[model samples]
Target: MTDATLDRIAGALAGMVLGDALGVPGELWPREKVRSRFGRIEEFLDGPADNIVACYFKAGHYTDDSAQAFVVLEALLKAGTVPPAKTLADDLLEWVRSMNGFEINLLGPSSKASLLAWSKGEDAEAVTKLSLTNGAAMRIAPVGCLVEANEHEKLAETVARVSRVTHSTDVAISGAAMVAQAVASAVAGRSWDEIRTDIAAIHPIALVKGEPTWAASVLARLEAFEAMVEKLGDAPSEEDVSLLIYRAIGTGTMTSESVAAALAVALWCRDPWLAAVMCANMGGDTDTMGAMACAICGAKCGISGMDESVVKYLETTNGIDFRALAKRILEARANFTIGD
Candidate 1:
């Protein structure tokens, strides 16, 4: 891979970690409470009395979003390609069972369900089919980056395989596939809109209205973001800016809404640090949204594009080494080519 490509990958990875960390502080707050307490949501608020943020602050780590994403990254780093369904399933089960130290910081419902099924002696594949949650989509960004675009079938199959190990609903699989395809398309220099459209075409049954319903919602919020950026300029108070964007875009159950909110922050904030901060402050499902935003913005800006503070936090706190991971992913991709 070229230095430029490697740099972009590093940026994306860093962005993901930054988003995860920033969002950890505000995982599940009601929209009104988030707005009232934080008064504009910037730079990880304290908590919503009792929410994921409080747990995260006490533990100093994230939930299943970051853990599972790391697992996906580790799997690719070890195998140099997407592992088979059984392999992925086994690893997931093992990870859940043997989780120790800081690893137990985050455990989502879908993962919990899978672990329960495994403990009960159900086949991993069968257990996964029973899930309809967003677990699969939450950790799929890495898959999109590793596979080649031409290998669409392989991509879909791999997504289905990995998702079925824990998430069985078609929505879960489709959401995961959408995220994977989005990351792949971004790495290949395609427009986000184009990528969304293509994924919709590929999985008409999985997506609502054959397009991500949230993209439009996100697009609508972009105008508001632009307005805020204009009014506040570069040094806008983080709290005020966060609330402005959050209220306009929303923080809710819809995956598109959450994803779009994060993307809007990235689009409005020229600085990667600001983008990550804004995303985390949005409160509801903050980590996932922040992670998604970071991935998209990181792809656009590169590692050099992020602020030193954001980079330092990710490196020291999260223990993420983007450059190394990027090299490993590239090498794995090359090996995949050779094997083919």
Candidate 2:
């Protein structure tokens, strides 16, 4: 409710949009190709003519990552809080149908397959159980920032509810929960150390059946991220960071790689813009990783920390009101927590 808190919330949302747009041009490019094409990706650039997915969208345009996150935001606003599973599922089903018919852009495989199953009258939980991508994590920022700073428990609960709509696997939910908890802690003004602890401590829900094997797989990546960040030390050169992220940590869209990559970048960089830039340079799944890393860093830095020109360009090109959406989410959180 305080001005500082609002600033952090707005900054986090702005960071997602900025990261999404900035990472567009390099989405599926290899690190070498990205460097060869754009040098360092410090600003917005158009998608290359050859990329089928990226070419459909323009410079400064966000793909499914931001679009899906905005759906989560709209759902939250409509419910005035986190909606129940069926309600959220219906909203997502509608999104899937709408996008499938009218594809100016494309949807991620994890989300598309899951929603398609649901549309065919398959069990919702069964449909989601097959998803193990970072799709859920990419759209979870709003949930993380939709609660009071100290409501870490509520944050996790809301994450589970929304995640189950599309990502029911334990590993997918766990990755999403980690990001959400970090966002909640950051918006509450927690230090990086505290935020890391909060994220590391979260436990994934079973959600009917669990994916312990997958969960362990993702946990190994998370552990590797911690070890890599510690080994490289803070403020490593951009080239060093990019190499580690691409070669060792990886930049895939799977929850295991992308979640760990994003968290690693976030842990290594204190500045929001720097984190986004580093993720962008690392290439593959750049938009999702960039969005994830920057959301956490932006929560720490606040809106004032972002470059004015980049933020202005995102606003002008994307036509999104990040600050207004942030304010509404904060207000909804206040309403939900009034009795707590």
Candidate 3:
């Protein structure tokens, strides 16, 4: 692997963990409530008691978004490419059990249902998947890392195959596909100006690989993001910019909304730390958006864009060695080809 890619991969992992931990304190908060409570979350804070989801964890701890992303990364390292659906499912089930996800209610609606069905002996492909959540997109950055963006067919196939265990709907797959492509493109040193167009084009291409659905399209949401960015003009206040994305593109857990919001944040606020704080305060699905957005930002700029103290704390808290993980991923990726 190239030295530059190795650095970006480390940054992507750190950025992902950092964003997740930062957002945990106010997951699902209203923008106003977030502003009223914390002003601007420059550092990690414990989840407020009233936040049912965030309340389960303490300061600087990544939530299920990054956890599941690690699951996918582990699978990729083991498989040296795309693992089978059952392999990924089995690993995810282990994560749910080991993390006490059921008792803690850490699983998303789609993932929980699919995991429960799979645990109950339902075939992976047979699990009912009507929900169109960002569960897949949240954990899909590893696919981006392992597969280059030029191989969109392979990328789409791997994304669909792995995501089948949880979210297999068209909308869900479309969102996941775009994120994976974006991260891959960013890691490859492509500018967001170009990656934005790549992801928008990738939406329809990957959409066809999953079960047809009537949900809001990720493409439409991304298109909406363009107008929101344009309206921000040369210099909008942070409050105004945050509200624009919250109100226009949204920041919810839906595959369409959060996925697009993450892309917008990655484009609008290219700094990894800034993106994390912005997502944390933006409300809705803060952690997932932070994870996604920061993954892209970190991929583009590497760990150089992150605060050294924050990255160090994230590594120690999570027992994560981003450099080591990047090396392992590079080794695994070396074994993969678009044909595989």
Candidate 4:
């Protein structure tokens, strides 16, 4: 990969964490509730006391989203190809144990249950039946960083394997596939429109994997977002679109809602910083959607194109060395191949 691609990769790494940290303060609140507390939420603030999960984290600390994404990165590197579900689960279990995740309440419901089941020697595949949350979609961006967009079938299969570790429902894997491929497309220098189109093409392929769920289709939700945008008219302000999505497309933990909302917001905001801020203020599972949306924006803008102050704050506060992580991913990117 070229230096530009590396910069985009690094930007995506930083962007996901930045979104998580930035949005942590307002997470799980209603739109009105977040507005009542933080107003616009432009800067990183301490997570609100009312937020059970976010309250434990200080300002600029990423939650389980970025943490799990790192696990996927580790799993991929160790596997030297598509990460098997067992490898992914072991890595996840180790990370959770290391972080005291179970005691701390950092994990979402699906992840908490899935990991706990696996830890108790439950059948891993069988345990994933009810995991229809956004846990998989929240962390799958790393797969996009390593895999190419053109490898759609391989990407779908890889995502199914990674997601089946914690989230094996049809909607869950489909959302994860969209996120992974969207990031891959952005890294490959595809335009926003092209990336959106690619997501549509990859959705059904991913939908075929995993257990069936009664949840809404992720592709249909994206179309809802598209219709909402058309009704929004031209050049609407960030708040207008954010509110529209909050009321219509939703910003919750379900894979279809959160993942599609992230994609929608990122495509509309187009600016990495603004996309993250929109999600932060939009409320309801802010950190997750923010991470997803901002990763896409970061993939497009690269590190240099992001807001310098925000990037600096993210780097300084978070212990991660994003540039180093990006380089490591690049080193492994060319050698690891996802199989059909």
* Candidate No. with top TM-score: 4
Q: For model 1, name the residue pairs that clash.
A: 40-239, 40-243, 63-106
* Candidate 3 Cα errors over 4 Å, as ranges: 124-128, 337-340
Overall lDDT per candidate, in order of appearance: 0.62, 0.77, 0.85, 0.87
Pairs in steric clash, model 4: none
All candidates in order of lDDT, best leading: 4, 3, 2, 1
Report the lDDT tens digits of candidate 2 across residue range 1-340: 4777888888888888777777888787788888898888887788888876677668888777878888887988887767776777677777766766235447777777666666676776666777778989999887778876556567666776778777878778888878877777889999999988878766443222344444445556767766775687766676777787788877888887898888878877877888888887888999899888888888888887788777788888888776777778777776663122
Best by lDDT: 4
Q: How do the residues 1-340 of candidate 3 rate in per-residue lDDT, one tens digit apiece?
A: 4888988888888888888899998798888888899988888999998888888888998999999999888877776666677787889999899988878868888898888887887865555368688999999887888887787788888888778889888999989999889888888888878888778778887899788888888888777767766777888876787888899888888888899888888888888898999999898999999999999898888876667888889989888888889878777776775344
Cα lDDT tens digits for candidate 4, 1-340: 5888889898898889988888998888888989998778988888777788798888898889998998888888877786667777888999999988889878999898888888888886666888878999999888998888899988998898888888889999999999888899998989988998999999999998878889999889889888877886888777788888988898999987899899998888887888888999998999999999999889888888887777877888887777788888888888887765
Candidate 2 residues lying further than 4 Å off, grouped into runs, are 96-105, 204-211, 215-219, 233-235, 337-340
Candidate 2 Cα lDDT to native:
0.77
TM-score per candidate: 0.75, 0.91, 0.96, 0.97
Candidate 3 residue 186 C-alpha distance from true site, Å: 0.8
RMSD of each: 5.5, 2.7, 1.6, 1.3
Extract clashing residue pairs from model 3. Answer: none
What lDDT is obtained when candidate 4 is compared to the true structure?
Answer: 0.87
**Alpha-carbon lDDT of model 1:** 0.62
